[model samples]
Target: MGNVQLSLALSGYDHTRDLVEGRVATPGIDLVAIQLSIEEIFYRVAKFRDFDVAEFSFAKYVAMKDQDVNDITAIPVFPSRAFRQSSIYIRAGSPLRSPEDLREKRVGVPEWAQTASVWTRSWLHHEVGVRIQEIDWVQAGVSSPGRQEKVPLKIPVGVNYSSAPDRSLTEMLLDGTLDAVLSAHPPEPFKRGTGEIVQLFGDGGREEEAAYYQTTGLYPLMHVVTIKQDVLDAHPWVAGNLLAAFDRSKQNSLDRLADLNASRFPVPWLRDHLKDVERLFGGDPFPYGVEANRATVGKFLQFSYEQGVAARQLEVDDLFAPQTLSAYTL
Candidate 1:
């Protein structure tokens, strides 16, 4: 039988580079990789089901699943994972001193149901004793003037979320209109090293590392690879094939990063940094499959339900294609 051809939309990350470059092949499928920004990929896939397979937001995916939008099903391949402690930004000289200080303050976010924002909110509510209803939430782009929530959200009662289509989060934060901004992408002013805005966790790297060690044992997930349900129905083998290929691609990337003889990245002390990461997250930090990520997935589902992004609490098994949930041993 001829190989099935499929279109895949994903970000240009090192882990996915092998799949994009044809170094790793899906068993009997011909993949057409279309690299795009995370926002574009998520928006297109969530709204239009544009690609046969795509990297999608975990929060949005759960929200869709909760709403019974089952056009797409996911594999256990997570393309993006991050610790979101650093995502929280506060203006300089603000009265707010800690995560607990966010109570009753205006906080802007790129989207109400963004994966990064979800994790950040979870950290605040769970670790810092700040409830969602206590913060006045604003939704807007981090850099640009207008950005809208792509998915419908059943916002919890007493959660004041407003849209500022005319203003960016950066502008609002700088002008004291917003006390904080929770976003995956740092606001433009913050990225430029302007003293106007700073991360709420002053020593973000150290704080994030400590938070990971103290709370959840793994870094929080941001995106997962999803296959169109129709594609899986027509080609049941595609699920296993895609999962295997993604696993191989990620291993290849990890191998490159762990090569100490030659520096894979241009950053100074990359080898040492890699050692630190390995020490913290183990040899295979970014693991795939439901069994490997159960804790993180379970916590995220709990957060989504609590935050009203997911109408009902979901299990990890329910989120992934059944065939991709487990693999047979040789």
Candidate 2:
């Protein structure tokens, strides 16, 4: 038999490697690596025609809307360490101290085309009373369609960091090139730096909003992995098997929570945040049992309609393959 093909999109999270490694150890699985941001996930879902299984972050789902794909079985939302809550970082020396203080201020963001940006901007408008149109937006990252692709509209005032290494933005934040940096959540290193958070862009306030976004009319966060429908049909069991393995791996990671805390990633400071590291174990990381997946599907469909991202309202029941929900729930 040939290898079991599996593709995953990732945020460069620490637990992501653990999940992929578990799949590789399985009897029949060939994991394909695609490092993607949440914005890219939407494009891949819209354009790609081949993929067996896709792992996604909750934010990515919120951005793309799950109904964009028809054969998703069970999508488990993993806790991204960076996106635990909404917060914006500004240089310690900057005069602006609140979200309301950011009128026409040049703000740095990884991707303006993403749902997190939308959610963040929405919060700034409704909660903070900051008009998004007035904010000088800086879009960072390589391959950002907003700037690099250049649609008819002028690109937002932002630097595309797709070409720069991951750590470059942190440097920019420190040097004062960026007035404030907005991410899903600031990494521990960013927090350790002299930068101060201006405002958390959500209704629940800083402490409670992260969990609230997961359940409310909030869109799924950006996730990177996806495969085309044809590949899944050809593979038959690959999609289900991968989700099962990831669910097992997620469980294993939680059971050995201490080990995960000690495990290292590219960033040492990120690994040192024990309290944050331990948070993934707090709730059902794999919240999408059949019912939850259905609920997410409904939410994504509603998001698409309300956001004008999609033309037709797709049913959550028809989105994933038959029995995918039942089989992957556990």
TM-score of 1: 0.96
Which 10-residue window in model 1 sums to the lowest lDDT? 205-214
Q: Write the per-residue lDDT of candidate 2 for residues 23-86, one digit (tens) a residue.
A: 4254467777666664455455545623345554333343344335444443443334233235
lDDT of 1 by residue, 60-80 (tens): 999999999999999999999
Model 1, which residues run further than 4 Å from truth? none
In model 2, where is the ten-residue run with the lowest total lDDT?
145-154
Quick one: best lDDT, which candidate? 1
**Residue-level lDDT for 130 in candidate 2:** 74
* Candidate 2 residue 98 C-alpha distance from true site, Å: 2.6
lDDT of 2 at 89: 63
Error of 2 at 9 (Å): 5.6
